[model samples]
Target: MSLPFLILYFYLMNFIYNILVHIAYGIIHFLSLFNQKLQLFIKGRKETFKKLSVIQSTDKTIWIHTASLGEFEQGRPIIESLKNTYPTHKIIVTFFSPSGYEIRKNYALADVICYLPFDTKKNMQNFVRAIQPELAIIVKYEFWPNLLSQLKKEGIKTILVSGIFREKQLFFKPYGKWMRSFLTAFDHLFVQNENSKKLLNTINYNNVTVSGDTRFDRVYEILQQDNTLDFINEFKYNTYTVVAGSTWKEGEELLVNYINEHASENEKFIIAPHTINSKKINELRNSILKKTILYSERNQVDLKEYQVFIIDTIGLLTKVYSYANAAYVGGGLLTGLHNILEPATFGIPVVFGGNNYTKFQEANDLIRLKGSKAITNQHEFNSIFTTLKQDVNVRTTMGKTCGDYVKNNTGATQLILNYINNLFQ
Candidate 1:
């Protein structure tokens, strides 16, 4: 690692990063012509600068950046807490994904909410100058060299919350020196687990805390809120209810097969598919043989008449979990798992497609602890599904384990808040 070689490597990675960033924006711009999501992404960023200009608090700002809806959940507790702790400081929340910005743009807690501009050096410089953030909080896996470097250059404190680091990631690779250089810019890193802290320590980043995931705190808060949904109560009506939340095509196949072949009249199902487009919803609805009703028809039909319910929209799945006897959470089959913690908080036995869940710590732990079951295919699913319906003791025990797991993982948000409070003190 000669100085010349190190310098050259830094220049090379920087060059490569710039090219990739511009190429990504180009691809997104081109695809926006055909895709509605891409159109939103492009359209939203067009107003980012304007949004920043209108922001009233320039220096008295706490800027939080989240990649999407999931990361926003990780950041939400802090956003609410910070809003209460420092009543006058403005919070600017930025999203890189349209999934997050579109859903939460009108959030009342944040003074400004907008899509973060593509991280060009100029854009990052302009954004930093415009917001002049006193502190920058990033929720989970977002790294932009330009933005991070600009923040560091301006002497702004920056931290990452609910961060999970893996050895397989670029930051741990042999050729990762260029990427690793930016880690020094962080004033602190609040990670999800001890292993993440260890990984950062390996890189000599000891300003790291194993504060766990803020999503734990977020889900725990769900317990305090009124999770009562009159519609869910009507649908359940004392029957055994299984809620399949965020189901993808592969997960839906397993659930549909089990429902069609094994379900009794006493068993009721509510499926909230990951993609709720009309075509995807119809495909799922058509696959099932039992009497099914869509959420769109909730007001129009008799709720108890249908054995299966398709939640063909967003925002209702969290509340629906409260009525579940056993929960089959989706996303593990194809797109990684959705929030099992949502149902776990409600004290329900959680089941999911287990093929792609080894990377998720909670998923692995839940399976090991017997709080949740992961089924690979139809046979495994049948076995688990049958057991959940027949054995009340087992169901109650597993549900308790799931509930305890959620209860134990909370307090990450408070730890982060304490650190932020100490910084200002």
Candidate 2:
């Protein structure tokens, strides 16, 4: 194709992309009228630009972008490490999802925490002009074309950390030529594995490095922290404990049934549901036949009296995993899986429903290492549960495998940091 025609093609593609983004924005705005979460999403973006207006342009800024809270966790170690190493540079964090922004808006490490503006060219231009970041680090797979292209045009150095690419992704498809062009915007991509690096290489994109996943580093660091929970200590009391983190309805049902049918006098279960809604909490409480105690109401009742403990709060799941002999990380039976690494870092044999976990390479890696199990139904759950409970040698072996998996995957953050340091020097 001629240079002029190729330029025209690029412009036309961008124009269509902007139109689709605007249409999606309109739909979200309409949905905001009925959905409280969507309302907060819209409200948060408005507040974000307002917050950005006051940020001084004189300060050297490092902008980190994450899709949600999970990606935030992946990027967090890097953020802290960068802040410590370069104390003069102001670290700014932006979230594409409302959940991440709402939860971590008050994060101490970030000088500014806000929602990323819509991916329109104008919004991208305005945001880049306001922030004027020296380096932009996008976590995981959030690839916003307009923002990236604008950053590239302005000569702002951008890199993607903890990036994973699969063979089936749109970037490799015939119709994905336009999307693939966005990959060129990045100065470097610090990917999660060799498979991702190879996938990028197939497209002749050599500016890639296999830095592993930062989540492993984050979980390992969590393990090093003081994870003492007084109530958990009292509740366990030397019992063989099963900590089920981030349970959904399907996972909870299976767990409740297993507890009702098979729980022994010396066995205990701790369930922390994904949502702490009163209705869902009550539903979970009533479903279990055993004496179940809510985390909030535990102080009023004797902890040892309950065989099933329902965690009715947030931010304690990782710490709660420290008290487990085995763990069931949930959400696999529903949409996807939650963090199995949190429990795995504690050296516990982890279990979850076998559904959609292909994107999470660690989940599959854990299975291969005999550190975790993916159950299809109650029968599989029972078998796995029984074995982990009865066979001490098996459990110990699996637990060690889990710990080793995490330990082996460490230092991705340091690798990424070293590259970033070189960029500055």
Name the runs in model 1 displaced over 4 angstroms: 57-59
Error of 2 at 52 (Å): 1.5
Candidates' C-alpha lDDT: 0.91, 0.91
TM-score of 1: 0.97
Misplaced by over 4 Å in model 2 are 1-5
lDDT of 1 at 289: 99
Worst 10 residues of 2 by lDDT: 48-57
Instruction: State the lDDT of candidate 2 residue by residue for 221-278, as single tens digits.
Output: 9977999999999999989999999888988888988999998888999999887789
The CA lDDT at 148 in model 1 is 85
TM-score per candidate, chains pooled = 0.97, 0.97
Give the C-alpha miss distance for residue 21 in model 1, angstroms.
1.2
Model 2, position 238: C-alpha lDDT score: 89
